[model samples]
Target: MKFLIDAQLPVRLSYLLKSMGHDAIHTKELALKNATPDTEINAISIREQRIVITKDSDFWDSFYVNQEPYKLLLVTTGNISNKELESLFIKNLGQVVDLLEQHSLIEMSRDSVIVHQ
Candidate 1:
């Protein structure tokens, strides 16, 4: 899967995803480095065909209400560190994909990965 990691997500997560053979790009790597407007991110995500991985709920709302072109992974872990985020993704990538394939939105929280179709 192709992924566009949100600014809040550690850039290392993108590297790890790429190492796992998935295409991933950090927000800083995008052209809109200094500007992370919601519409811009959504537009770029759609244009690039990349699933957005973010900690922000706005992206979920944007994709959900707008029925945007790509998928979204909304992380809801509380006060998480970079290592925790990466570990979570590493430990549950397969399950994540399964959820994503079955639903349009996947929310990875402290307790579970919630899926919404």
Candidate 2:
């Protein structure tokens, strides 16, 4: 799956996704870098058909209100170390991918993954 990692997430997450053999890009790679607005990000997500992976609830709100991004993977794990975050992805990514294939929105907490209607 293709992914557009939001500004709040580390660039390393993009690299991790790439390492897992998916097409992924961090917002830092954008022309506006981390300052890229949510609208532009949503546009990119729609145009590129990339699943937006973010911790930002604004995107969560937009997903329900506007549904412009096409797909979303919300990180609701709260505060955690980068390693812990990466580990969470590593452990649950397979299930996450399967869930995303059928659901427009999926939430990943520290211990479990939730599929949102």
Candidate 3:
């Protein structure tokens, strides 16, 4: 899967995703950097067929209401350190991918990964 990592996430998360053979880009890599607006991110996701991985609830609202992005992986483990956050993704990403293959939305917390279709 292709992923667009959000501003709040560590850029290393993108690197880890890539190492796992998925294409991934962090917001800091974009022209607008971390300041890239949500709408623009959504647009890029749609254009590139990228699954957005974010902690932003606004994307959740946008997906529920507009359904513009092709896919979503919501990270709900609040305020974790970068290392812990990366570890969470590393531990749960397989489940995440499985769920993503079968659903449009997946919400991942520290202890669980839930699918929302």
RMSD of each: 1.4, 0.6, 0.8
Rank order (by lDDT, best first): 2, 3, 1
Candidate 2 residues lying further than 4 Å off, grouped into runs, are: none
Q: What RMSD value applies to candidate 1?
A: 1.4
Against the hidden reference, what TM-scores do the models get? 0.91, 0.98, 0.96
lDDT of 3: 0.92
lDDT string, candidate 2, 1-117, tens digits: 999999989999999999999999999999999999999999999999999999999999999999868799999988888999899999999999999899999999988899986
Give the alpha carbon lDDT tens digit for every residue of 6-114 in model 1. 8888889989999999999888887776367767777877898788888888887777689763889888997888888778888889899877777778888876878
Q: List the residue pairs that clash in candidate 3.
A: none
How are the candidates ranked when ordered by TM-score, highest leading? Answer: 2, 3, 1
- Compared with the true structure, what per-residue lDDT tens digits does model 3 show for residues 1-117? 899999988999999999999999999999999999999999999999999999999999999999967799988988899889888888988989888888988999999998888
lDDT of 1 at 63: 78
Question: Distance (Å) between predicted and true CA of 28, model 3?
Answer: 0.6
- The lDDT of each candidate is 0.83, 0.94, 0.92
Q: What is the lDDT of residue 60 in candidate 2?
A: 92
Error of 3 at 64 (Å): 0.6
Error of 3 at 108 (Å): 0.3
Candidate 3 Cα deviation (angstroms), residue 102? 1.3
